[model samples]
Target chain A: MAETIEMDDRTIAIGKNHKLFDVERIRADFPILHQRIHGKPLAYLDNAATSQKPKVVIDAISHYYQAQNANIHRGVYYLSEVATQAYEQARECVRSFLNAASTEEIIFTRGATEGINLVAHSYGRRFIQQGDEVIITTMDHHSNIVPWQILCEEKGAQLRVVPIDDHGELMMDEYASLLSAKTKLVAFGHISNSLGTINPIEKIIQMAHQVGAVVVVDGAQAAPHTPIDVQALDVDFYAFSGHKVFGPTGIGALYGKEKWLDAMPPYQGGGDMIKSVTLEKTIYNDLPYKFEAGTPHISGGIAMAKALDYVGQIGYPQIEAYENDLLNCATEALQKVDGLRIVGTAQHKASVVSFVLESVHPHDVGTILDREGIAIRTGHHCTQPVMDRFHIPATSRASFAFYNTKEEIDRLVEALHKVVRMFQ
Target chain B: MDTDLRDLYQEIILDHNKNPKNFHKLDPASHSAEGYNPLCGDKINVYLQVEDGKIVDIGFEGSGCAISKASASVMTTIVKNKTVEEVKALFEKFKGLVTGKVEPDMLELGKLAVFAGVRDYPSRAKCATLSWHTVMAALNSKEEQAIVSTE
Candidate 1:
């Protein structure tokens, strides 16, 4: 067992200066961080794309494959029973992680993309009707936007988009104005991947509920950084990917209120999701399995539970505090550089620092930074609507995790300084 | 992170990106076309001044990555003073080079061959091809079509 560090209310109130997170010790937990990329130590700043998994999560996957590799819920053998128990345990773990009411409310998905699609197809397709509107935000990932767009098109529903301001915060007034009797669903991301702005999801959900619209929160970005309490938030549906949260790539979870899930149609047709199949018709299984069709990523699901445990052990308050400090340090350092412009300065944000050097292309900045072994994502970041809103083609994004340190932020700043000088 | 800067950002490519040739809109041009890569938000407008069957003047104006800007600069340099057929062939050759269909020979490509490094990085191939694709669209355009293709 790893040693647990305690943080009292005073330490938490004082901000992230507490020594609960030793950068070197945290770095030791992630084996991939030790390597050199181009002769320089790898400074991974691309946590928004995906996070590096800890040894515990990795070992969980290996151990599952070694000891209990079997098909779940079908066979009556001991190994099968063990595998099924582990998988269901994972579901329960996810339920607790998201603060869902029951394990039946959680469904395993391929990733956040599939999770959104499942809700769009299963719930949106069934409840949404012609002339109805499904409101989404411009700051949403294409995963959240495209699925709803396809669903709206198929169902003859109108797709309404909530716009964002210059600072990349969603215009709450516009969202409220867009809501009406015709609005059937209001889908939004809990955190903006490109901008790193944490949306006011609780307020958004409450407003949508007031208008009798179901709320679907894309928790892909939020789940990795903050503690998610779905019950407290009162969201209708919440989706997140395990890979983003330092788990395996093939697994994710979708949390729905049991009432909504039970009322929705099955997402996909398969053997495990069936209760009884006849020549005339087939009866579908209950809540979660109705949406989880295929032989799930059994090992991935199990490992995801381990990843969540790792995050829980660290404590979200401490992690968020540390990450916020890194973000502030990075923002200040980059701002001191000549011709550097940091994008997305929202009042509330996570650890993403997206910036662009005047006259230096983001690709050039990214390439030059790579020489220093500083990994950053430089592109539109799949939020083209946000890019369009900014009137810029792309920006270099450096996202942080709890494991990141001020030393890494310094390295990134130094690399940015070098890149800006080279361009000048 | 050190995944071969030479493969993605060659020195010549960087130079061209910093100091792009024909980096202006050709006013009073016979043909013009805009190309957009939605994946990275790279947009470019290729302006061609075609006098008779030859491209007498070529220019471009847009904002994008180093690969895109360099590719556009090199594209204008290669296509200028060449016949329409020759320009088309050069486009095909450049496309083939970036897509790894053909190994770029510096002797054959002159300054434009520096983009051969882009072949190793598949995601940026579209960045290198944006200019060529835009030029092709410009050449093929009639008065009826204004926008060609936005990938």
Candidate 2:
């Protein structure tokens, strides 16, 4: 039976999944995971930082550059026309992938960082006045926090923070208390990059909407692991990076509600973002194009669309189910390691497992793991505030994907035991 | 079991890391500076009591990995009673050792030579010398914080 999502204003129909999602077949699609490192097989568990690309996504990008490399929008010949079609098609793909209301609501950005910066500047400049309150959670990445800090500094607005509990879960009571009429903006992450906390965004959006505050959700960490419907969430703005979702780097999308996009000014002024230019006054382009300036990352966009298709083909339910199994496998395996204190054990967590070993530093653990060809992310993870809240230097983070296996988790545990032995 | 691991974490280094030498703050110190490695959030507060050009007593307080904590501990033991210029020279030699720039005689380094293995692991080089940089920051009267990043 087909699935249908009921939105605030409309309902969208979804097709049924047909293919048997085999993990072995999926592993073979990524060419990078087949290699060896330090005389051992590579187990790339750094998916939180970025994901390995499938061959089809790679081929699609290469095919674009080899055959259809031309500037888009302003076209004269066949190649440009083809390029423009592909670019626009990518926009449509991203719109549907995010389940946005329309393609006109999607704007190409440099990544999630640029997306947040766009709203912080554009929306903050016009709507957020002096003494207005902007609330963000303690678990947000630096990308989500810094832009708002800059915006608040510029606008004389007070930036408030929602704290998190020991389990890395946001204090929802505190969040509810933080809401007020003076709260002009509320920026938070759907999934914490450091803690892997899957925030209650549907409720967060509803609460922010009650306060008349525009909500900007950092979907960078969530976009890869979970299926998102912007209309269903009714979020004012959503931002995510393509690279994290198995797409090429330097390309991302910012999905804004049409009303907010209409009111907000253009982020950057350059070619392709204007309707017409004059010596005195220039007319801006319509929604989406108004924010996208300069010659965009054409190949990145096309390949990102392919990546989205790759995920859509397999379906998010399968991906989430597989990843949850892997996460559980990793969590259970890590518990056997002596004196291993997991940093983020949120009740509602994603595939990321961050922990600190007793008397062993994360950096040292990371180095030792690298020797065993286990690539884990070890550092503050750009959520330095989260590190401070935990009273830690850093934590070793092993984020998983659907293609990752339980065997890899075994290798990680074995390597960590070696780390403990070495320190001893 | 590997030679690299052996060299990186010698018995002396491990001893210092577990039971660090001069791991307390030198109260009534003449000079002090804070060191931070933003990469790992490692922090060290270097303290020294200098009389004339020679440092009489030195100590540090902070949390870091075995390499950094051990290096800071080892540094306090070696740099005490050494002149500022001598300490600066030692810093240059130690920096060179970790970076794989100059392979000085291990005996010449004495207790500091244990860090020579850090040369191979480029990522851990900063951990080996974050405290040394802080001492420089304190001795030279440079910036307020000696931020070392192994980027």
Compare the candidates by DockQ and give the number of the best one.
2
DockQ of each two-chain model: 0.54, 0.80
lDDT of 2 by residue, A296-391 (tens): 999999999999999998788878877887888889999999999888889888999999999999988998888888999999999999999999
Q: RMSD in angstroms, candidate 2? A: 5.2
Model 2 regions lying over 4 Å from their true place: A1-19, B142-151
- Tell me how candidate 2 scores on lDDT: 0.90
Deviation (Å) of B145 in candidate 2: 8.3
Top-TM-score structure, candidate number: 2
Worst 10 residues of 1 chain A by lDDT: A9-18
C-alpha local distance difference test of each model: 0.87, 0.90
> Model 1: which residue pairs collide?
none
Each candidate: RMSD to true structure?
3.6, 5.2
lDDT value, residue A313 of candidate 2: 86
